[model samples]
Target chain A: MSDPADPEAAPLSATHPDQPRDFVAPGADRDFAGERLTVDPAGARALLDARLIAAHAAGDTARLVTLYAEAGDSSEAAGDAAAAAFYRTHAYVFALQSGDSRAEELHRWLLREGREE
Target chain B: MTVTDSDLAAVSAPVEQARGLPNACYTDPAHFAREADAVFFASWAGLAFAADAPEPGDVKPVRFLGQPLLLARDREGVLRVFLNVCRHRGMILVEEAARLPRAIRCPYHSWCYELDGRLRTTPHVGGPGTNRHAAIDRAQLGLVEVRSHVWMGVVWVNLDGKAPEFETYAADLRARWAAFDRPLAFAPDGAFELEVACNWKLAVENYCESYHLPWVHPGLNSYSRLEDHYNIEAPGTHSGQGTRAYRPMLAEDGRRFPVIAGLDAQWEEGAEYVALYPNVLLGVHKDHAFAILLCPQGPERTVERIAIGYFDTAVLGEDWAPMRARNAAMWKEVFEEDIFVVEGMQKGRHAGGFDGGRFSPVMDSPTHCFHAWVAERLRQPA
Candidate 1:
């Protein structure tokens, strides 16, 4: 997947089909830039998005955290601060699940808006 | 087989004239079901010991009164109880006790909850890796917290959320034993449980009065004579017996554990036992106190969770461990000794013609008081 022009867009490491998040079509991982990720031969990117939606619907917090973090970028790129904060807050939940630095970014963002609970 | 109006009428009479509760109150399925809600749920029941979840992020799941409950300590080190069922799919959440680092994650769906019971994450609810949906409101749903209070080293819960404040329900007994009002740190050694083959009510009845002590606990009778004990009755609250000759466990070197400060000279060798109505047996002494949280598993099974606490936590260092062990062993023996009679009384309740038996006006006042309290609570509109 090609990285988005906006510096604020989510990191594209996992966006590539070769990344671990995608196990559907091993070699096609690099084809997932935006919509092509959806319209590919197997629509791996689209399937991944759909799977993420399904996971959220099923109350899968582990999957939801990354999905929400990714959603924050889209919401921010679309100029929806409230929506971005909400998605970031949701991602921050999974961030708290680990001691790693992933949650720090979400924490700082939410903390700036006085939304850190 | 539920409690009929006639059953309620039997325990309503004055102590001198009243009979004990009928067999149906203890044996009937209908009455037990009613009690699951009205008696046990509506009233303040002793649920667990505070020491069970002593630190922040410690989560313990408790199945109380047939309801799944979670005892959790939050990030800020505050402890609270919540319904263990998840709000999303009604799944049972924390099933075991562990030090949960950040949040309680539901195994069925990974719906995460803050230690304080807030529903913090709903994962993919929005759409493909989307955790947002306009209809999904995080504020609208969180884990349901059960009403609870910690007192005297025990955790007490009001399932129906209508019982009076703990201070109000226990004011009388607290005032009577005001001398031992200081903080009580439970000694680790003095913890044990007894599974009694008797109805829960039978255990409570046996504990409320000292009328059977001379016969049931002959060892205790040697030092604490029957006449040295008096009945303690607080209508609608607590009732039991008190003794002036409380025996303290002495080490081989003739050393006794430190006594609680501010205890009156009268407490030099005195102790009191009180049955906090519904289901909790409490004992207070000059140096230590105990709460026996009776878990009523069924009509004929009661598990006594007993914990003994000292006046101060600092007093429980390794040096006092031996004394604590002796104290625990002594109490365990005393409690085990009373088992037969309580189980026997439960067996006797099954007799076809036992008309709720009768109470000895002179010696059974405390038991009668408990009967009255249970009768009064059971009679209320459910």
Candidate 2:
């Protein structure tokens, strides 16, 4: 019977070890160099695509922002400016929508690349 | 044909000489549409409960008066109202009640808006990878906001955005119950809805007077007789009945809800039920209060959105669950009892010979006050 409108009635949040993490910090994917994975470039790209699809389906804007940014970074690393801009645009949109501070960084990068007004 | 000024002349007469509003006011679809602008939209009408978007990040999409609206609680916990559409492409936004947590993204084209209704992102607006357009001004393209205010847990909106401030509009009733003015603790389980087969005004008219109580709600006659009630007629604002014999509901274990602090001795057994002008019915007692928003779905249908609240949050705990349930059930039963009469009266409106009927001058002044208010409002130049 607790009033849902009451701020005091909101349930407290606590992290459990067994719970699956739905959030991925921006640029955290770049730290994967320390982990071992014997996948080719195509397999890695497919994996990133799968992760993006899952994040989009879950409506996980934070994850979408991070994954899209990671995709943009990968495209840049491969010297594909057009593809990089496309992925960065997706990241920037998600970042802005989620109110993530990374939107400022993404916007700056897009502006430097002359892809944004 | 619509209910013209001539049709409402009889309703605008003195209480003793007046007939009720004509049948067309209640039975004609065309007249009902006209009332939407003149009677409801032009006045401060109840839109939804503030509880609908209770906490920060909560958002609810509601269709009231056939217009889609979004009710949201911004990050600072302020309740806001906006037209439920994206600034670009005019797509509906926030199709359901849920936590926004960050921003609102239209599913159609992925356009984003901040919880405060600011246009945050318009992806690919300038072309593929470009978001900014020289002609697309984000500041000028935020979600359209409707004029809104929250009082007594009801989110009141003036659709035309021209009504006086809510405090000024409701000044008389606010001053009348100034003592009962305190933080209202919503009884979570105390919310309910009753879809009556009647025009929305019929429900308001039925709630305006208490003359039918002895016969309509016979159960209350034991402790609260017809004579215990008095008319409250505020000419152009509101009208209702006040009962001096109101008794607080008690649980089987004899527990009673806490009374609002600093109330005068009169509220101990006194309570007032008011139909605040167009669409909201309100009641305040020493222990608790209730609000009912009469949402007009069409000419002959109304959904009575009811919510009850107590003086404080004490009734929200597990210890007070039983008492809260008992109190909610008691009011629900009382409200249900009145449904048939309003619906029957709605059906009676179709009777060709019925000339809006007559009122008992001694007992129906509150109802007459409401009828006159509606007639005068409808007669105004649109």
For model 1, report DockQ.
0.14
lDDT per residue as tens, model 2, B237-353:
899999999988888888888887677888888999999989999999988999999989998999999999988787889999988888899999999999999999999999989
lDDT of 1 by residue, B25-121 (tens): 7777777788888788888889999899998889999998789999999888888999998888999998789887687877775677889988877
Candidate No. with top lDDT: 2
Candidate 1 lDDT at A91 equals 70
Measure candidate 2: CA RMSD.
7.5
User: In candidate 2 chain B, where is summed lDDT lowest over 10 consecutive residues?
Assistant: B1-10
lDDT of 2: 0.83
When only the first chain is scored, the TM-scores of the models are: 0.55, 0.71
For residue B334, model 2's alpha carbon misses the true position, in angstroms, by: 0.3
Residue B73 C-alpha lDDT in model 1? 90
